[model samples]
Target: MRRITLWLMSTVAAVVLLFSYRTSTMGATAPDTPGVVGAAPGVVPGGPAPGPSAGSSAPPGSTVVNGTVSQTRWGPVQVRVTISGGRITDVVALQVPSGNRRDREINSNAVPALRDAVLRAQSADFDSVSGATVTSDGYRRSLQAALDAAHFGS
Candidate 1:
């Protein structure tokens, strides 16, 4: 009886502890900061490269546009696209969720893939990263917005 009781108590305590643990996703709210479309102030080592400044002039037939901020459950996602000669020449993620280690890891893997896919497909209708669905969705939304802002492909 004593052994069983001790085991039961330990199990109950473990369960309680597990239930009380907080995750980065719990009760989090998206930030209100608007996305910056120009040469960002600082660059994340493993994150997207900075695009040209909004005030800078694109080549005669090229255009640069910043996507709207997309609020995901983890955080906001945004991108900037440069279209040259009527094709998507480059893509830069202006903002991506980096609230925690996991966010950073997921995006570090996902953002580059998304950017490459956009450049190849020349649109936002591309396959999302396997383990980063949320981030991918936000990326697509922002990419589409940027394309629209630039009047790309239409």
Candidate 2:
């Protein structure tokens, strides 16, 4: 009886936490806080969609490079980096770990956060997404590859 009571209490607590979080975040109503769930400064939606641009030509004053594809448990993670004026101009996710609706949702939320962090830090050393550590690591590695290819210093 005591074990059952404890288990039931724990379940109830977990449910409460879940709903509270959902209620707080479901609407995306929070103000833009950059490097969080909101868009980063100078970032465009679907920014520079990632792709293979290695050895390919980009417009003068700007260059695009593709990162290595990182395979995660859910799927693969890949990205592209844009460089101009010796600085990182943008990041775009070409491929993400998406094998199901849950995967899609998780990646969807994580990618933006990762991008924002990368742009802000101008490096691969950014905070991992709250619920997407695997994807985050893959993204960091892939982003680093693109930066290396571009010979980016910062």
Candidate 3:
């Protein structure tokens, strides 16, 4: 009985110590390469953009248009489209549900997939991530807006 108590206490202490060390070291290490992985879209080591260009206009040949900021339960979803020769050459996620870890993870995965899909389809008539329906819906909605603004199809 005494040995059992000792083992339990030791295990608890070890767990506490592990957590303590993790919490202490988490913020100590700085980002090796800023503006890379885990960096917010259009963000650098300095800071985020001054503000979101919610509904910016497009240029003549190459257009840069921001889509609607579709606000979901988690957060807002938006996209920026780059068009060249009336084709979607690039799609950048200007905003996504990033209030929590789950939101970040989901967007990190879903945004890239959506970008590729949209680029391939050449329109917003693409599928969303199966698990992340809300974010996907927002993506589609905003993508459509940007496409409309760019006058891609019409």
TM-score per candidate: 0.68, 0.62, 0.61
The worst-scoring run of ten residues by lDDT in candidate 3 lies at 41-50
**Global Cα RMSD, each model:** 8.2, 12.1, 9.7
RMSD score of candidate 3 (Å): 9.7
Candidate 3 stretches greater than 4 Å from native: 1-60
Off by over 4 Å in 2: 1-59
Model 3's TM-score against the true structure = 0.61
Order of the predicted models by lDDT, top scorer first:
1, 2, 3
Each candidate's number of clashing pairs is 0, 0, 0
lDDT of each residue in 13-95, candidate 1, tens digit only: 99999998878875235433353433323222223334534345555656667778788878878787778777888888877
TM-score order, best first, reads 1, 2, 3
Worst lDDT run of 10 residues, candidate 1, spans 39-48
Across 6-92, the per-residue lDDT of candidate 2 in tens digits comes to 999999999989877643223233312232222212311223422333244444667677777776655667777878777677787
Top-scoring candidate (lDDT)? 1
lDDT of 2: 0.68
TM-score attained by model 1: 0.68
